[model samples]
Target: MLVLPKESRKLFKGPFGILHRDISTVLPELAGRTVYTVGDVVTHTLQKNGITPSIAVVDGQTMRSPCSRMPEFSGECIRVENPAGTITDDLVKALTYAINHTPVTIVVNGEEDLAVIPLVIAAPEAAVVLYGQPHKGIVLRTIDAGAKAAAQELLGLFVRVGA
Candidate 1:
């Protein structure tokens, strides 16, 4: 387990790719690339646009509140337990498994916000990881050596707990 510090918010400010107010605007860029959605809103937006992500990670909540029933996704469903403000070994394993399986939905028990870190780290080169920026818009991060390195560096700041 790893606890993220409040100060680490600065590291997450700049996205690895573009931030689009309209998710549809980035559809062309997602073509021919594996898409990994790290939030409920981002996944729902993509589905509404008729685009299914290769992997969707959701905790059935938005802004710490219950979401409108989980959306129906077409793929294998794997559930894992992850607490708020922290990442667990289970999440890392689930992300690794989901990336390998492809087209799977990871239903997290607690929160899925920080899942983007591991998603960026485990995603294949050229893959796109999408997540919502609260009331702002959607952030599209392209998985590359630089992005992976940055994610790893940020994750290193977390305080690791028991395995």
Candidate 2:
């Protein structure tokens, strides 16, 4: 749905939502909430900490390197091809399905970094979405009017190139 333009790369360098240095702190806030995770490390960390998010989006890579420990979820695994700087239609379909069907893991063939944008836009209100913040930590974004607007703004910054 959104494609990153070369000139706008700098805008996405940091986290789009609340940055939590410790994922544990965010875990307590996540109790009894629908959570969707994006990025391998973030998902693995959550699982290791005893929190199984409703959905996880992973690309088998972290920081552009092959992930040593790919997050494993025993649920419906949907695979889609989303290029490094773009969100594919197939991927959006998977995420849409995941919303109704909780406990889904989306395995991206290319990259899952940018998937957070569309996921946030499509996520139901009050849902929580988590993703890594590069060298910092995890970001906790709640799906609400403000968050959705922020995500939509970020996506808008990307050049819309597809029909």
Candidate 3:
């Protein structure tokens, strides 16, 4: 089970927690002490509310799109390596999978500036948000709009963990 604090969403890589049903052992702390996703929590919540969410994996897509390609920067003008395509088929595959699975919320951690678009279009009701870094682990950028508050909370949690 994964119990991720709402604030820690950014630092998390995949689902709040990836549990092996057979082994039944939790991994060591990945980041701060907080547990973002826990099966027990999810189970209780589901028993109380009757909800199950699928997991959506968010990957990156180049800014350029079909029929256009980002050139290998050797000189002044940027060139298109492949005019046939801009976005990769794998990205489409992942997105399509997400649509089919229909998880409760799609957590996006892609590098694109505005990843919320496709995710929103694909899963309109899903919670599309980004993650931030842990203060002690990385300096983290101020411009990361999604992770700011989470980072601050992570920092506080870190101090608590240290104490």
Candidate 4:
């Protein structure tokens, strides 16, 4: 597992990609492509808008609170335990598997916020990762060399931990 140190908290404060209040404009362009969503609100929104993402990472909560509406996915469900502000090996494995197996929902027991970091690093070119930015809006990250590099930079902020 890797822990996000206190100093790194501020590093993850802002959206890492383009922010959109309305995700509809981006949805139509993503048809027949590998799209990923990382948050309950965004995942639920995609499902509601009839755009089923290829792989979605959700923690069953929004804004750090138990969400009243949980995203319902018909495909395979992958469960992993990753505490808040930390990323575990289990989470990485699940994400790697989900990327290949389309239409999967990865339900994180603790939190799914940091999952996007590894995901951006693992995502293939041309694939888009959309996540919610709390009250701000949705963030759309188009996976590519730059996105991977940015994610790697953030990954470096984490301190590796042992069992």
Candidate 5:
């Protein structure tokens, strides 16, 4: 494991464990694992922007409401539709646009069905994903080995990337 300087290591002892150590290696790996969905991307972007996303409501109607009142975030909002049935060029284009755009931190709040938003919105080269419950500090199903690994990797990245 990589070690930190004395002051850095001390700061990492408790809840700060999330922000400890060599994270440059972790961000890119985590970005690869994130699934594509609108809500998930928005939340991930918000977090990256340094705004603690308090919650996400999944219903499409909620997304329709204006985000004017919502606090500022680091990333753009993206929409993701089911790939098999309703996927369209427009949606894909939107995802590409969002991803190609600059990084923005955001807290995602949306319906469960749209959880993959983060993956689609992130730049192909950028290693970031939305796969956790910020409030509970949990992400991707823990029992699923791949999912867990992806989440851990993303968490490591987020700690350093949030700046």
Candidate 6:
């Protein structure tokens, strides 16, 4: 497990890829690529646009508030518990499993915000990982060797918790 330090949290503010106000604008780029959504709003927007992600992670909340309704996904739903500021081993394992099985929805019991780190690190090359950028828009990161290395570097910044 890893916990993000308060001082280092700002490093995660920037987007990992291109930003789009609407998911429709990004749909054309996602064709023939594995898509992983790290937030509920991003997953909902993609689903509303008729694009089912290869793996969708949602915590049933948006911006720390309870979502009006859960996003609907047509694939198998795997539930995992990840707190607000920390990533657990369960999350890493679930993400790995989801990467192996396409069209899986990871229903997080806590927050899903930081799941993008593992998603980017473990996703196959050329896979697209999408997440909401708060009030801005959706950030789309296409997985590559550079992206994987960058995500791994960021993960290294997180303080390991427990044994």
| Model 2 spans with C-alpha error above 4 angstroms | none
Assess candidate 1 and give its TM-score to the true structure.
0.93
lDDT of 6 by residue, 1-163 (tens): 8999999989988887889987678889999987889888888888888888889999989999998756796588899999988898999999999888878999999999999999898899988999999888889999999999999999998999898
For model 1, how does the per-residue alpha-carbon lDDT over 83-149 read when each residue is reduced to its tens digit?
A: 9888899999999999989889999999998899988999999999998887878889998899999
By lDDT, the candidates rank as 4, 2, 6, 1, 5, 3
Which window of 10 residues has the lowest lDDT sum in candidate 3?
A: 74-83
Q: Return whichever of 2 and 5 wins on TM-score.
A: 2
For each candidate in the order shown, give its overall lDDT on alpha carbons: 0.87, 0.89, 0.27, 0.90, 0.33, 0.89
Residues 1-163, model 2: lDDT tens digits: 5688889988988888899999778988898888899999999998998888899999999999999978887489999988899988899899999988988999999999988888999999988999999889899998999989988888878776758
Question: Candidate 5: worst 10 consecutive residues by lDDT?
Answer: 12-21
Please tell me which model should have the higher lDDT, number 4 or number 6.
4
lDDT at 12, model 3: 39
Clashes of each: 0, 0, 15, 0, 27, 0
Q: What does each candidate score in C-alpha RMSD?
A: 1.6, 1.3, 18.1, 1.1, 15.4, 1.1
TM-score of 3: 0.24
- Top model number, lDDT: 4
Over 42-145, each residue of candidate 3 has an lDDT whose tens digit, in order, gives 22222233333242222222322221221111112111121111222333344446556543222223232222222333432313222211121111121233
User: Please, what is the TM-score per model?
Assistant: 0.93, 0.94, 0.24, 0.95, 0.31, 0.95
Q: What is the lDDT of residue 92 in candidate 1?
A: 94
Which of 3 and 4 is the better model by lDDT?
4
Model 4 bad stretches (over 4 Å): none
Model 3 score (lDDT): 0.27
